[model samples]
Target: MTRTLGIMTEGNDVEALYRRLAWRRQIVLLTGLAALAFSLVLDVATGPAMLPVPAVARSILGLAQDRTVDAIVWSIRLPIAFLALAVGAALGLSGGIMQTILNNPLASSYTLGVSAGAGFGAALVIVLGVAIPLPEAWAIPAMAFLFSGIACAGVYGIGSLRGSSPEMLVLGGIALLFLFQALLALLQFVASPEALQQIVFWLFGSLQKATWPKLWIISAVLAVSLPLLLLDAWRLTALKLGDERARGLGVDVARLRIRSFAIISALTGVAVAFVGTIGFVGLVAPHIARMLVGEDQRGLLPASALFGALLLSLSSIASKTLLPGAVVPIGIVTSLIGVPFFVWLVIRSRRAFW
Candidate 1:
């Protein structure tokens, strides 16, 4: 007699996976919409003017036409909301991609030092008086994107040389992060007190400086980059297995890594440029998305983007409304929630990141 151990993909597993994806997509879309509506409401209702929810809604819809409400909604809140969603989405998706590529759960815009690079760049502008001469509006993110790109490039190049390893990538990122932090410190040391204050504020992060133009720039970056990342979702998902494994399955590991690095760099760079170093959303949102959607890139990537948008939008609203009189910076709010979540994620997934 011969006995065989049988392997099967349970019908329940297949149905459960599909059902979960459908449910998650619907939930993500609905919650994302709800978060948007709530963001609009908070935009009109939470400012110094404090308009009623219905009136604020009407003004947004262009039905009321009250100048003050319209101005507040259009000139102020709308831009802020849009920036939060767009940056949040970019960070979220970047974090997801980083984790997938590195196979590390703690990977995020902040944790991996991408934000530190951007912060250092912004700090340079603040200290050197270079960015100051430019339109005050374009300064921060300009420096941010530039530095983030360079820093990411540095990390990737060092990590992907012949016979390079993931360990080198993580180590290099950490080292570069400290290097940038040192640069920020040196800039702060030579700066005047007032200039130093500006640098400090940017380092901590804020949305108080947000405007419609800046929002447009950030939104444009996301619009251009997100589709490209999504288009490569299949190759990205394949990266979860080892590069050698992916190659055996006919994936071009080198090309995939280069493409992913560029996309992640741009995503994180744009976000840090616009908003400073808002932490936790990218790391947390993608993990949440993975938990909900399994490992499929098609579902996982969009889910991270949607959830990220909702997370940041909600955080922005909370920072504004929670204090009742003082408008909290979006970064502060995110860090408060993010730091703890990150700590927990790392502790839980010690094998991955540690």
Candidate 2:
């Protein structure tokens, strides 16, 4: 009777421990959301006109209507600021999903060739001057999204030949990365000087070209993708235990990975398609999220999206303020800031947080 009581006591302790962890995760997510909100207002306020944060906030919320403030906020800066959040969230979520499904801490859309494929497609349009029925603005992103899908198909096709094992899929991605890079280089070699300059600028990544339509497209993609991925959250968490274990858990491990990969491709494609090739958000945000929230997809994925949006919003603010009048490309700022911070995170974490 005493031994039976001890087992009951142990079970209660385990349940309490889980409740504590869950509470802590909730706090972490709330903190990230708070930070993201602050950063978005800051980003809108930091541009050359230098509206006060309260002014920006008031304008954004329709609390006040100064024509000058409204024009600058609604006409100029809001699209850029909001798009940064959307793209960052998309990349962050994509990175989190990719890392989880591939069982590789290092995996991301940028590393795995989806970004490369999109960049190549954009560059091809710029160089060849492709004249589709859509306006030039729409044409490039259309092609970029298209090629991003092709990259997903390529990864899936190649991986399936080897039974869709994670190792085989990763190898296929690396090979495609190289292939796309080489194609991009060749396009650069033959491109006209003007077209080459355009290519170079596009590759640098900027939010300067942001517009309401582009912002809506990405926001819509995020809206659709997030719920769908969240629905599979339990299966994704199960897959982290290892393929055999996940299979034993009645998760269709292969199907789960493939579905996740396709979603990552679409997210990455839409992100880079509009803004060009912003890199480190996809690679860094997920690791930071995982460290804070652990590997449960419900927490990890949304935390990753929040952190990613925060990082890029911060980057966008720096891009404007860094050079005082000339806006710096956001991609440069992200790499410069993200690399050291990422390395520090990697070094400081003593255990394998993955």
Candidate 3:
């Protein structure tokens, strides 16, 4: 009887430990999410226009008497802030899944060369003036999205032909990256000075081009993809245990990889289509999330999304405020901020996350 009582006490202690771990993950996720929200408000409030938080809130609520403030808040700052959040979330989630499925900590959305393909497609439209059925604004991102999908398909095809090894996928991605980069260079070489300048600026990845329509489109993509990703959370976590182990545990590794690749391609394509290539969010956000929450995909995925949103939102705020009246391109700011964190991530730990 005493032995059974002791066993029950031990079990209770184990259960309590699990509860504490769960609570820690919850706190990390909530804190990251709250930070993202606060950063969004700051992003909307700052910038060249410079509105206070109260004023920005009032403008959002339609309680502001000032038409100019309303226009600035609703038409400009709000869209940019929302796009930052959406794009960041998509990239972060995509990155976390890519790393999990591939079992490579370095894997990211850009690892499959989706960004390069999108950039090439956008360059073709900008430099050669390719005509599409849509308006100029819509046409560029449309072509970008199309080519990104094509690039991902190519990588998958090549990887499958090579038996879909992780190394094969990485090799295929490298090939696509070089291929699309070369094509973009060729276009730039032939481009007129004016077109060349536009291509350069587009490649710089600025959120200054954000619009309400673009915001809605990206938000829609995130809304659809994030839930799907979360639904696969358990399976994705199984994937981190290596392909053989995952297969032994009843996961169809090949099918999951294919499906995950497709979803990642769509998410990444939409993101880069609108904002160009914002690097490092995919690479860095997952690392931060993993460090905070460990490898459980259920918690890691949402935390990654939150951290990604926070990083990009903070970058957006910095980009606008770096100079008095001039806005810096977001891509540059992200690189500046991401490089330090990336270096820290590399140097700070010798432990294996996977």
Between prediction 2 and prediction 3, which has the larger TM-score?
A: 2
Model 2 per-residue lDDT tens digits across residues 1-354: 999999999999999988988998999999998899999999999887799899899999998668889899999899999999999999999999988888887788888888899999999899997777888888999989999989888987888899988898888889899999999999999999999999999989999999999999999999999999999999999988888999999999878887898898889989999999988898899988888888889998999999999999999999999898889999999999988988888899953345
Best-matching candidate per TM-score:
2
Candidate 1's C-alpha lDDT?
A: 0.78
The alpha-carbon deviation from the true structure for residue 242 of candidate 1, after best TM-score superposition, in angstroms, is: 1.9
Q: Report the error of model 2 at residue 20, Å.
A: 1.2
What TM-scores do the predictions have? 0.88, 0.97, 0.94
Model 3 residue 5 lDDT score: 100
Task: Provide the global lDDT of candidate 3 against the true structure.
Answer: 0.86
TM-score, structure 2 vs. true:
0.97
Per-residue lDDT of candidate 3, residues 90-111 (tens digit): 8898888888877787778675
- Candidate 1: residue 148 Cα off by (Å): 0.4
Kindly list the per-residue Cα lDDT of model 1 for residues 1-354, writing each as its tens digit. Answer: 122222234666778888978887778667766866677577547766577888878877789767877877878777777778888888888888888877778677688778999998888777775735466557767878888888888878778664446677777778788888888889999999998998888877777767877777777877887788778777777778777878888888777777878888888887888778888889888876776666778878887887788788888877877787888877889888877876776677643352
Q: Give the TM-score of candidate 3.
A: 0.94
Q: Order the candidates by TM-score, highest first — what do you get? A: 2, 3, 1
Question: Every model's Cα RMSD, please?
Answer: 3.3, 1.2, 2.0
